[model samples]
Target chain A: MKVPALVVQNLTKTYDNGFQALKGISLSVEQGDFFALLGPNGAGKSTTLGILSGLVQKTSGSAEVMGADVNADAFNARRYLGVVPQEFNFNQFEKVIDIVITQAGYFGMTQAEAAPRAEELLRALDLWEKRDQQSRLLSGGMKRRLMIARALIHGPKVLILDEPTAGVDIELRRSMWAFMKDLNAAGTTIILTTHYLEEAEQLCRNVAIINHGEIVQNTSVRGLLSQLNTETFILDLNESLDAAPLLNGYAVRLAGLDALEVDVTKGQSINDVFTQLTASNVQVRSMRTKSNRLEELFVSLVRGSAK
Target chain B: MSPARIQWVAFSTIVTKEIRRFMRIWQQTLLPPAITMTLYFVIFGQLIGSRIGEMDGVGYMAFIVPGLIMMSVITNAYANVSSSFFSNKFQRSVEEMMVAPIRPITILAGFVAGGVARGVGVGIIVTLLSLYFTHLQIHSLLVVITVILLSAILFSLGGFINAVYATKFDDISIIPTFVITPLTYLGGVFYSIGLLPEFWQAVSRFNPILYMVNTFRYGILGISDVNVWFSLGMLVFFIVLLGAFSLWLLRQGKGLRH
Candidate 1:
């Protein structure tokens, strides 16, 4: 049988202060899959990443990368995994090129062998121009890109990004998304944890939502989105309406003088709402979802798990 | 590459990076010790030595040179590792080493090697500075090399341990100020321990720095208050004990891991 990219079996972590961070969380990611592990803050997402990367020890159970146990075969396991932590952990005084090249050295590559790869990654990430500059001198977005370059220097089979674009601007965030999509397409398995639900919806093929140290939901993105019984969209009308619009078999309410909120159930065609709106003499200007679909699902799942 | 070769590459990489870190800030790492040692020679060797005359049948200036060299080696070695490792901890850059596939021993050795390099580097600079103050002589080349290298190893390990337990910037400074400075001064870097009364002389034996100084003095002046063999044994013993303790701490994930 082919080995999974990452596997966790009954993993648990309890801190020294008697607080349990993880409680027997199990997960698996197939090779070359784009996976998302979503959780609210203090929901064990970072702790799970910490355990898998050998930064934090597990109190019980096990985790493996490419079938190599993290505890018993850490060297081999780590050889297959790369982690971009939530915080910037490289030396601020070191040059960008040095940081990426040094990381490759830690993986046992000579400077001669690491230089070309470091250069290529830097160029790919648009950081080659800033290669000679100290890391602290780079902009926030550039620093984030430098971290990605450093993590990818060893060319690991599995990459875990813990909020890789946490504080980035929209343009930079989109560019990072495109880069990550290309990376995933090239057969590198990616597991990301992000607060931005839109990123998870757009990028991840499968996802696991963790709440209070447990896996609350694990399913393909399509399956999870399919579970949504209804979706709400807001429509801006060209003409102001004094009263709420009444549409047969659809719940519609006037949100503002010129806006309407409509709830469309699963299996109900959105075309029905347009037909009803046209018949009611409402001319729509623009339309948008009230909230991201995955975000709604995430909030509901976390609330259910909390209870 | 083979696994052994890979381990060597990682080890060398750490050492090289560490060396570069210090060299990049030469004013902080290399220059201060040279300036400090030169002041010591002027105050203690030139200004006072002429008044005190010869010590143990040698010129007073010549007598104190080895101890001063050893003193430089000891302090710089300890300071280099302590400050470097503690800064790595504070900045969280040590996470790079923690997550690597390198063995624990290799990590420990890398930091220790960096400390040794700085220690020995400063020692060489101090030795060259002492030359203008006095005519230096080595009683035994073997002892001179052994004592200098062993002292560097011993204190580098000492510095590594200090960094392990340190949680704050002030914590790293406390041991060097309260502990290392006093021990080094009382270690007989200037005068012979025999000048003290029998009771004080006995107390001096327990100070590890005394053995290091006296043995290094023996290497230079052919005179020592303590047995040379016994001093060598103590140096080796401390190196082993401290090295083993350091390796254990790394494996336990003491300061670097969680």
Candidate 2:
């Protein structure tokens, strides 16, 4: 759709000493997509982001952002993208307003244009109150938010966040997610790389899981979670069942001192399990279902890809 | 509007910000060199000069003024860029510039230009300070201007390289201490090489900084211990080499991309 917001084709990066960081990664992000790139530590996620942003040099292959080749037309490619790096990169000695405005200046914005945009972004990010404060004086959450504001100052079509909520608290994290979702809805494409699976599951409609410099899975959120059909049900019984009985073909395990966990797969109804429990003369105190569609899919994908 | 205009805007922003950063910290950037040079004038020019007398048909005070001024220019220009670039690297704020739509050459030019501003600014301040101690004269105004500008450009390139290679706060101190310090001291800032034996004079010629100071000295007093053309040639040579080297480092993303 519209040439996709970004196109990364066979992107490869190998550091000196032959340490390959990205091994021919090929992916595309559609326009207005809330895309999440998920991976464990050292899973080539940063390498991929770095190359896409024109920070890290790619060893081979090509990438394009907004129809502009990242390596060949880096300046033009970058005009459509903004990046929030993982580390604190702003000058601590600079005032918050100056940091954002200077970032705008790098894009050739005059002071008249950059100043108002900087203030607007700062206000939107809730940094207006501390606009004049030195960057060193900002708290961790404030600093992270400042980075978001800075990235948006240029009014880019695509925004990349590299671990935007790595050390932030739950409230700020949720609010930041809301802000990102609103931005995406308003037509700014978001490409996020995060260690937080829950955030990915909640906010991202599309997900890409990278492991060991390769994409293990790239699918729609619903499509990925639908792969997990089984639900883990816990039953607390009033009386202890005798003989440590083995159920007929049902996968079961002891969850706690008085609870039994039954993993029910597709084609097996919950009613059948209840009927079978009644026949065994086991008195059920309470029953609860643990819906782990995302977790289950995540674990299986990571484990299977590791092999 | 045009690409040239955009590039100039970016370059101006970088240079302006650098000037502002240093000017804001005037106590550290401007005051220290002035005080140091004042001490050198008092101790070396007056205290020692009265005892040693003049060596090259000029007052020892005026003799050392151009050298001191050049020393300040070289060091400040070098310091301004090296510290600024390294600080950006250490803080990771360089990412802001890196992620933007600016060209690599634009970034290099912005930084080198910033260094040049600070270097020339501090040189002017030190030159004025030298006036109070000695009567300054200009033998060749063109040489004086050319040497100052060329010297600043060369050192700015060296500073950018240093910043590219520096990883930590402590890492930045290595080159300035072990390399820059020795070069400046041995560059004939304090004494002319004519006073030294023939072997020492040959060794002094190997220093790139000697050419810069002697070139400026020749500009100021119409006297020199070395060939002016030779000094000019070396200055141009290092400028090209260091300029190419700095640009290559930027292209390679050396120590900057990690």
Candidate 3:
């Protein structure tokens, strides 16, 4: 049997001040898979990543990278793992290329070995022109890109990013998405944590939602969305409607002069709503879901699970 | 690669990065110590030695040169590790090493090596400057090399401890100001403990810097206030104790880990 890319079981962490950051969480990422670890603020996402990255010690249980135990055999474990932490952790005074090259050195690579790899990552990330500039001089987006270049220098089997695209512009975010997809396609397992649920919904096949220091939900993306009984879609009507158009067995409300909000249950066909609307003289200009499916499900799951 | 070879690479990488860090800021790390010791050579060695003439059967200028070089080495060694390690912690960049595959001893030794490099570098610069002011003689080259290396190693460990416990910039400077400086001054840098009265001299023997300065002084002039063998032994004992304590600190993740 092939080993998983990352295997974390019953991992727990309690800070010195007695805050239980992780309360025995367990999960795994398959090899060559793109996985999402999603959570609200302070929901053990970062803590889990921290433990896996070797920055924090677990109180009990185990975490492994490509079958190498993080505690008993950290050298090999870390050699197979790469991490991009949530914060900007590199020295700001260091040059951009030096940061990536230094990271490669940490993995026991010499300058000669690291330089060519560094150039590859820098060029792929579009940071080649900014190589010699001090990291402090780069803009926020470029700084984040520099970190990405650093993370990939060693080409580990598993790459974990803690909100890698936070605060990045849309164009950069899309480009990063493309880069990540390419990496995933090239046989590297990816584990990502992010606030943007659409990124998860669009990119990940498998996901785990953490809440209150525990894995509240773990399943495929399709499986999680299948649990929602209904989806709310907003219809953009070509003309103003004084009241909601009557559609039998559907909860429709007039949200504005030009829009109507309707709840479409799992069994109902969207074409039925369109057919009913045309008959009622409500010409539909356009339609889209009221919000991201994953976002809504995540909010409802977290709020419902809250004590 | 073999595991041993892997460790060597990681260790050398850390040392190289640390050396590059200090060299990149030579104005702060190298120049200041050289200039300060030169000032000491001129003011204390020339201006005052002219009036005082010889002490311990040698020119007062020659008497203080080794002490001044040792003093510069101690301060620079301590300052280099303390500032570099603390800055890494302040910026949280130390995570890079903490998360790496390297052993804790590699980190400890690498930082100490960097400290020693700066310390010895400053010492040599001071020694060369001393040649311009007066004639120099080497009484015992082996003792000079051994004691200088030991002294730098011991204080580099001291700086590592300070950086581990330091929570702020002021904390890094506090021990140096209150403990190290007082010890170095009373360690008989400018004047011999032989002149400190019989009772005070006994008290001076307890100061570690006293042993280092006197042993280093004996290396240069073949004259010292304490037994050179006993002083060298004390230096080794302190290095072992501190090196073990520093290794324990890295294991505990004090101030470095959450």
Candidate 4:
């Protein structure tokens, strides 16, 4: 039988001041899977990743990385895991390459053994030119890539990235997405927590959504997204419209003077809406989903769990 | 790699990083102490020692030499670990070790060894500098080496504990300034405690630094106000005490793990 990449069971955390961060939540990630763990702010996402990284001690529970229990055999457990935290956590005074190599050393690699791996990861992340430069001088996006290189230097089988692309520019975000896809395709099991729902939708095959310290939904992205029966899109009108017209009896509303909001359900042809809009003399200059499909389902699930 | 080798490599990495940190900023870490001790030698050993004549049976300059070197070892050892550990905490870069599989003992030993490096490095520099001032003879190199290394280890542990509990910059310097400095001055570094009144001499005996300073003086001058054997035992006691307390602090994760 193939062992799971990660297994967290009945994890709970309560801060000293009485705030419970994780309420006995449990989840698993399969080997070689690109898994997304999504939640809003204060939704226990970072707390979960913290526990897995052994940064925050759990109140009560167990976490295993590649069949090694974290508490019982930390060396064995951490050997298979690589973690990129949300915030930049390297010594600012250290050079870019030094940070990556130092991390390799922390995993027991010699300077000679780590040097080539550092070069390969640095070049892959487009940071080889800045290898000798101090990390404090790197741009925010470059710093993010530097951290990714540091995490991957040890070549762990499981990689957990917490908001790795936050504050990164669009182009870099796309490139990072490509890098992550390549990492995943190369059989690295990745568990990612990101605010950009579209990024999750694009890169992840499996997802778990948490709300109020509980796992509200967990399944394959396709299965969970398939539950999204309706999608809402905002259309840009060529001309100002004070009121939204009935478009093939689809739910419609006026979002702004030059915008119309419409809801489309599954199995409905978008062409029908275009035809109805043309007949009503409302021409849309552009169209986009108000929220991505996964986002819509996430909000509804979180809201439902709240109620 | 075998587990033991991996652990050894991990330990060496931490020590190497710490050494690089202090060495990279030589202006702040190394240069100041050498300069400060030179000033001490000039002002106290040359300018004033000529007037005061002899202390115990040795010339005043030679009398204060061992104390000054020991003083440098203690201060540099304490400052090195305290500042480095606290800075790592402040920057949150200490998380690098927290996330690694290294044992807490390995981390503590690495930091202490780094402190010893600076402490011993400064001791050697200060000792060489002392030779220009007065003629010197080694009484017992074994005692001198033992006292210096153990004193360095003890104070490094002290600094590590301070950094663990410190939340602000001021907290790191508070103990060194208010406590360590005053105790070191009263540790019979310059004047023999025999010059003190009976009651005052007894009080000075309680100062732990007195034991360390007196023992190092005994190593260099072969003269001590305190019992040399008792002083050696006291140094060992303090090291064991501080070492245990330091390991406990790491285990508790005070001001460290959340």
Candidate 5:
């Protein structure tokens, strides 16, 4: 059997103040897989990443990267993993290219070998033009991209991005998403922790949601979404309604004079609701889901775990 | 590349980055020491030494030259590493090194090397500045090289320790202000310890900086109030002890890791 790209077994972390941040958290990511780690604030996602990257020591348990134990074989383990932390950790006064090239050097790449790689990543991230500028001068989106470029400069087999697109504009976020997709397509295993559920649902094949230092839910995105028995969508009508509309065996609530929310169960289609609404002489103008399916599942699972 | 080669590359990269950091700010890192040392030469060596005439049978300016150079070396070396490492911590950029594949010793050595570079660089600059005020001769080139290099290494390690324990910018400055400056001034940088009373001379022996300054003085003037061999042994002892202590702090991940 092929070795997993990353693995955590019963990982636990308790800070100096006796506050436990991670509690027996276990997880694995296969090679070439795009995985999402979802959690609320302080849910151990960053802590787990920190442990894997050797920034935070684990209180107990073990983590392995590309079959190398993180604690015992740290050099080899780190050799296969690249991390883009949630914060901008590079020296702001350093030139952009120097930051990326220097990061490659930290992994043992000589300047002769790292320069081309740095250039390539910088160009791919659309940061080549600003290579000589100090990092402090870059825009927020550019800095985010620079961090990604720095992480990729070493060409590690696995990449872990902690909120890589946090605070990014929609356009820049989409561009980064495309770039990451291309990276995954090139066979780099990626583990991402993000608050954007839509991004996770769109990009990741598998996901694990943690809450209160425990894995509350772990499954393929498809599997998790499939567990949702019903979905609610909002519909806008062409004309204002006088009162609530009756539909056959369908629950509907009037949100406004011209809008209504309808709950549709599994195996039922919005077309069926349209058919019933047409029979009631209500013409629909627009329709949208009340929330992303993954978001709904995340909130419910986190709430359930809270109890 | 082999793991050893990779480790070397990482070490060299950190050293290079640190050197570049200070050099890039040459006005701040390199210029101030030269100007300050020149002022010391003008006031203490020229004006004060002219009045004193001679110290320990050597011309006063020449006697204080070695002490002045040693002072710059120690202060610059300590300042470089302490401020640089503390800045890395303040900016959270040390995480880059903490997460790298390099061993903790390599990281410590890299920062120390940067400190030594700045220390030696500033020492040489100060020595050249002293040339205008006094003619200098190297009494023993071997001693000159060893003492200067050892002083740089010792203080660089000292600076590394200070940086490790520092929690804020103010903490980094506190030691140099309260401890380093006083010890350096009292280290017999200006006056010979032989001029002190018996009890004060005994007390000065306990000050580690006195050994460093007196050893460098012997290197330059072939005159030392302290035994050269004892000073050498003390310098080596402090280097080993502090080196080990700094390495221990790195391994413990104190201040740099969570």
Candidate 6:
């Protein structure tokens, strides 16, 4: 019942070249929730993030961060939010610690406070050892981590990340995820956009998918996965089939040598397919799920909306 | 820290970063200009002046000193900010400040102040070098200081505008080469405007740099070529105009906006 940390109402944006980036997008994020925004390239995710952070002007619509109108009171609104841009954009000549501390200063923090906070955030992100190093000297992943630490320095209530681990390695990505989850558990509302579906599957309790500048889906993770009525399972048959075998009551196709691909829809049972195959004197080998209902649901929704 | 204090800290931090970038590569950013200015004094005052003799009741060397100093101030101030800002754009690092909570006006002031600092620094260096060739007679210390400071601020603002609109390295060089260089030369940096034909003298009144160099000359020599009040009035007007334009560009997110 507490007020959501962010409430975006019909947020729209159009560039001068007549490209519509956001088409009346509306959504809300509950306080302290870890929300994931999933989208393909050029799907308005960055534009939405820009509008929320007050960097990009909206053609129409309104957004409120912690009840502060982003358009009307940008400074107050921005004060409550922190943004980690996808691009590596800090001044290369600046040291890592300076980058983090300067971000704190923008919100009016003194050196006494910002220094310790910067150190803490940098150390927490495993950047303490690189504090004195110029940002230009840091590796790509290190620079990206520095940006994350910079965003957190002001102790903003809401944190927005745009493709935080786009090109990062798996190990670093997981560590970053763990750190973000910890922040969210500590009560910072985290909003992130990513192309990594499994990351959303594991870390986010709620997910929003945007396509062609419009919100296609906004719901709890479980709720969205539940929308799928069909799932695909791959069965490694004991023997290879020369042709597509008949498996009644379910769609079945040859996956590969010694494998059968089976798809089960709503109101149909895998037992029916198994019973028919057994009756036909077919021997069963090993079996495994090829695609989860959740993945199927997401793919169908995004791809369907694309068309 | 309180909010007001945080904003000031952010402002100073950006300015410091800008200063560091230019200083770190002093050879590339600072050295070339000093060398170029030194050559100008040598060739123009020594070589050319020997043939033209004295003008404006002062030695050929002294008559061109103020013009040369103003020339260095204008070019350095304009170059410092324009190149610095353009480099940020090329490297796409200006986004660091863009995403932060700092006000647009503070960002404008920070870069402009950085540009002014470098401009004044280079101006003084060039002036000290000038002392080797001629004595710098101070007609009005206050006027001399005021003219240098204002000119620095004005050109720095112009540089910021250049950086904002420049999309490439060529974009940065185009204005300095075609616009700024020609204006400084045509502004009477070497010879007095009285030598020009009447038609050309009438056309000279329109050049802004002429007003600037002439104003600096008036300060150093206590002599007037054009109305001193008109020059001072134009400098103030440009400051306001440039300030407002730079702020507007900042708010609009010019090249740094993204």
Top candidate by lDDT: 5
- CA lDDT of B240 in candidate 4? 91
Q: Of models 1 and 5, which has the larger lDDT?
A: 5
The residue-by-residue lDDT of candidate 2 on A1-307, one tens digit each, is 3878888899889988789888899999998999999888888999999998878989998898999998888878888998998888899999998898888888888888898888878887889999999999999999999999988887899999999999999998999988998899999999999878888888999999898899999999888877777889899988775443466768878766677888888778888888887888877899987644676777788889899
Models ranked on lDDT: 5, 1, 4, 3, 2, 6
Query: How does residue A50 of candidate 3 score in lDDT?
Result: 86
Which regions of candidate 1 fall more than 4 Å away from where they truly are?
A: none
DockQ of every model listed? 0.78, 0.63, 0.72, 0.73, 0.82, 0.49
lDDT of 6 by residue, B58-106 (tens): 8888889899889888888898899988887877767666666778888
Q: What is the C-alpha RMSD of each candidate to the true structure, in Å?
A: 1.0, 3.4, 1.2, 1.9, 1.0, 3.2
Residue B89 in candidate 4, Cα distance off native in Å: 0.6
Q: What's the lDDT of the predicted structure labeled candidate 5?
A: 0.92
Q: Could you arrange the candidates by DockQ from highest to lowest?
A: 5, 1, 4, 3, 2, 6
Q: Which ranges in model 2 have alpha carbons more than 4 Å from their true place?
A: A233-292
Q: After superposing candidate 5, which stretches have Cα over 4 Å from the reference?
A: none
Model 4 lDDT tens row, B72-135: 9999999999999999899888888887777888889999999999999989888888888877
Write out the backbone clash pairs for model 5.
Answer: none
What is candidate 1's lDDT per residue for B126-201, written digit by digit as tens?
Answer: 9999998888888898998899889999888999999999999888888889998999899998998878999999
TM-scores of all models? 0.99, 0.90, 0.98, 0.96, 0.99, 0.90
1 or 3, greater by TM-score: 1
Candidate 4 ranges beyond 4 A from true positions: A235-246, A253-260, A274-286
- The CA lDDT at A181 in model 6 is 90
Minimal lDDT window, size 10, model 6 chain A: A291-300
Kindly provide the TM-score of model 1 when superposed on the true structure, using C-alpha atoms.
Answer: 0.99
- For model 3, which pairs clash? none
Q: If both were scored by DockQ, which would come out higher, candidate 5 or candidate 6?
A: 5
